[model samples]
Target: MSWRRALKDTARSGIAVEKKRLEPLIAVRGAAGLAIVIALSLWLFGPAAAASSAFGAFQAAIATFQRSWRPRPELAIASGTSLAVSTFLGYLTISKEPLFLALLVVWTFAAGMSWAAGPTIGLIASSNVAIMLVTVTLPTSVAQAAGHAAMMIVGGLVQAALIVLFPVRRWGAHRDALADALAAEADYARRLRHDPVASFDPQPLMEARNAAAVTPRQARRRPAELHGARGIAERIRPVLASLADPAMGVPAEGPARDRVRELLASAAALLDAAAHAIRHGEPVKVPPAALATFRTPDTGSILAGAPYRAMTRLNTLLQDVVETAGGAPQDGAPSGARGTARSAETDDRSTSGRAPTHPGARGTARPAPTTRSRPTFLALIPKALKAMRSELRRGSPVTRHATRVSAVAATGYILGTWLPLGHGYWAPLTSVMVMRPDFSQTYSRAVARLAGTVIGVAVATGAVQAASPGTLLSGALAVASAALMYLLMRTGQFATQACIAAYVVFLLGMGGEEWTQTVPERVLLTLMGGFLAMLAYAVYPAWETPRLRTRLADWLAAQGTYAAAVFGSYADPSASNAPDVRQALLTARTARAAWHAAVARATAEPVRHRGLSRTAADDAEDALAQLGRVAMLLEAHLPERGATPVPPAARFADALRESTHQGAKAIRERRVPTWDAVREALDAWETENPENADKVVRNTATLVLDTLTELSEALDTAVPPMTLDGTAPEKPDGPRNPKDSATR
Candidate 1:
């Protein structure tokens, strides 16, 4: 990537139009609310007050449109209250330039730091600061400022009331999220039928989990179908993978393979049916053949050992999915008692049921899976504060963004005020709206803002000049422009900016500004603000390209920890000192997410990937994904607590932990790493009596070795790879058992 290429890519992205489904009903509702507020304000307080108060309804409506799980009314009220406070506070300092400038700096900095919480919070906060800069200028006296503030609250209230009265698809987002997760699982099952090793992206499941967290107020009113289905979906994914995977003891080309495929196809069909039912809030119509496939006793005879157990688990789980998604009440009765038919044989066998074992093997209780309680809205404040405080370090991207944006904002305001432009606030306002934490968004938004302002300002000014509409008609046009903006909000930044620009023009016209006098000032000031924001980013960019290697290393380390934890459970099934598998898995997920986000951001950056090429990055991601998948498979079969311990696994787990810790450091230092310790551990385990070893432990260990070898090979392609002592790294040995190799 070069400067020229980066600029070209971002420019294209800036102008790209997305095809999105229009929410006509929601758009009309928002527009109607804005119209009602405008009408009342014009009748009682005239144009200036109307102009100031209109922002409350407009912004509150925008807040409701954000992809958040919080209730719409809550978002509206929060947005309105925050805007009113900002406007009221800004009015008190408008009398003195120094005081107002100081207030502006502190406020903008806090808004920048809000990004640590999340994008939704950050955007809403930033919008408030920009709105404050404009709204504060509308009031002349303290009493007038108070009145404007009160009207802003009223505007938010009006929008909230309408939403409550005319609700459209309550819990729609939650239903959609859950449905998407189920749909993704369905797709994964279909893909696995052709290629059992196909990768599955867990992003949809992660989003569903986020949506599942609701405030107590919401939980009381939530639909029954939304409950328990997500957990069942999570359980189904691993079972499907284990059943399809040949390494789990199913033959690649035999009757067993056909059974696996048949089971996969049935699972896919059932999952699709469940997804459709949940998404559309309809009755679940399980395909008779799909249910019959699960009920067939022939499946148990075709697949033996691990595959057989997986089949049994799948049958029971599918019944749960059908019942839960179909909104059937969950009583203590068997799933067969519910609407969906269940296999009598599968129903009698518990997943953790006692089975005939080897002479020395022992059974143990499974550890209870941990669940996190979702925090309430009020409870999240302290968590947000903690997150913000953590990002105060110099190296944090959020901190850098805060510093860069604050500086740009202050400079833009000074230049805007010192220049001859009458409406100087427009300059800094544009800068505030355009800037973001990353290069792509900031540059793209800058371009979008300038173009949209030109087009928007032109159309509105031309219409005003031609129609010569008075205050009443101007208010109507403003409302119409806002409605258009809402309708096109998700289409692209270009259309959004255009509507916004036109809306502003009409709003100011209602306040008695001549189009000829205000038009040139707005266009020029917008260009000035956009350029300032772009220049600030170019000078102080927080490039993710340079950090790609670090992100990869972090992910690798997290994977190693996860693998070690699963192995530790096998080593000492009853040992309280074993690492928490749940916590380890969570850490790995977070690291993987961070790595993906970095890659996405880096792809948009102008700088060349310093250590990793595009192909190398993709390969590395694939290897790591495989590594995580194998670990997840092992986790699915982990020995229960107090089970007979495989002592050799303890040494292997220690070796894995130590070797990967060293490997991560070697990665950061730009040197290829060797897995000599892991190889030696495998060799030692093989040297011990081969026939007496636990088969499950033996097989999964070899899979771990294979994945690690692939990971090492992937990283070997890094640009300018280095080695220690002028020698290449040692590769981990393959499966110790020849039979294990055949199964793999």
Candidate 2:
């Protein structure tokens, strides 16, 4: 079969295999969801009935909300409102005024429902106050009020857990898609560097140059324009000269040409994949075979070569162009304008019978070019306005998620209020704020809540014991609570502040009870509430482990492809292209991000994903960092107009690419390459190119093969083999950093 046909068939087969592998994971997730529902139902009716019922109801509400809401301003308001209403209901139950309590309950419930349906914090707060007034009239004892509060706490906890376990699918999906795009981009960059001639048609280069020349001055101000300009210049440099003359048909004469071409193609494909992933939100797949094709050469000799020196000169030229344009006078300037005036005089003299000024004429008085001014605040206003207008015109996906989160919070609030789950009424309120799918935020909130509860309980116990229950004492406590709440709120630690404030209110509302006698009970109740909140936060967990792992794999794959392209480009220097350079940079950036995230997540949840936990994430991060440095070198050496003293970055890129591919291949095949053999190949290449003077262009096929193979092998060994069900093994017990394990 033709190589092209074989390649196409392999790609198709690989995709199919990957899809099949993923099916079981989807099934496992579904089953987990069902199991949670059943467990929660059973817990609600089991021996710890009071706590269970309240917690269960809250959990159910949160679950429903997660299924519906998208995080946004509207949802934030809705969730806040739901919390206020629940707080009011707890107050009503404690007061024991049946008629007033019933009315307030109805009001709070209705308000919560309304807020959930359409988010508004003001409405929710107003409803909460109305319920609180009714609570003041109830004839209940302090003990009874505390019991109801306990139930509320339990309910909120359950809800929080469920939300954690089952995160919204859309967010995860989008993240995965972004990873795919990055991988494809890296591949593209590598290919272009390896085989510039075949990878980029001359027409596009010409068109790009024309566009650059004709681009509106204002358009150049865009950030992307700068990147595009640089990329185009680098990619087309080699081809530019050839296109001008057409006599530079320097074909590869050896076996290396075919290999080089293949490497270039692979790099291009990877970059294309990355672009697709970023644009469309797809998954990234790195092929194992690509890694087995190349070997890296030593870069020291290449760096000392004449071609490398020439490339450096080109970079200086490009810089000069930028400076020249920046220094130029604006169009339509007055004849006497500072910089232009001198140029105008020169032109006038040249047009007349006088001697024209030499291009290098200096020491003569010439008007300094008008300095480009920095943008002012007023100048930025139009851009800001444009952005705002764009946002207003476009629909946002986040809004939907926000709404769902609010609805869940509201549901939890109402259920906790109505169920009367003993002295932990505030637990549901805690859950509303703490139960986020993003584990990082949730964990932070939970810790804050626990700390605040401890402090609040201590204060309440001391104050209650010291003061006799009466109007004056209660009023004083209330004032103190409000003051503390206000102060803490400014710190932006909402959950902690709320917990402290609530405790003060609980103490004041106890109606003259002796604090010394009730200290133990109060502490226990507070602890219970905190415990419930934590549980709810963890129950419905969305495992970040798989996502992190997958991202690492994709990044490694991209690096391998990039390396191969770099090698090929060095072997035959005429193949540089703009798209390839851009892809390399983009892929490197993505890989860096992925590595960081994985490391963080693993540290946060070390015990959950087998022994591969945070350590594995760290290792991957180190590897990516090394790869990133190499990519930067490749970027630096890309051909550009008028460049001289080019760095040996292209040769380095080629060698690195080969090494990486071989490492990856070894990992995938479960056969480690002899370190000496790999080293020897690299040494030989480096020796031949010491100053890498050849100027012969490398292509994709030659660069990628060995590096890809090595990379595949390394990654396979580092990460566990995909199970039949396509899931990693459960994490083993070990000391782990909570921060690293948590995912946001």
CA lDDT of every candidate: 0.81, 0.38
Encode model 2's per-residue lDDT on 186-297: one tens digit a residue: 4433554444332222222222222222123324342221122222233323322221111122234333334334444443443343334333434333333332222223
Evaluate model 1: give its lDDT. 0.81
C-alpha TM-scores of all predictions:
0.91, 0.38
- Point to the candidate with the largest lDDT: 1
lDDT of 1 by residue, 631-737 (tens): 77766565655578888888888888888888888887777656878878877887774885587777777777777777666777775556655455554488533
What range of 10 consecutive residues in model 1 has the weakest lDDT sum? 343-352
Model 2 CA deviation exceeding 4 Å by range? 1-425, 438-444, 460-499, 502-530, 533-539, 557-588, 606-618, 642-710, 716-744
RMSD values for the candidates in order, in angstroms, are: 5.0, 22.1
- By TM-score, the best candidate is 1
What local lDDT score does residue 640 receive in model 1, on the 0 to 100 scale? 55
- TM-score for candidate 2: 0.38
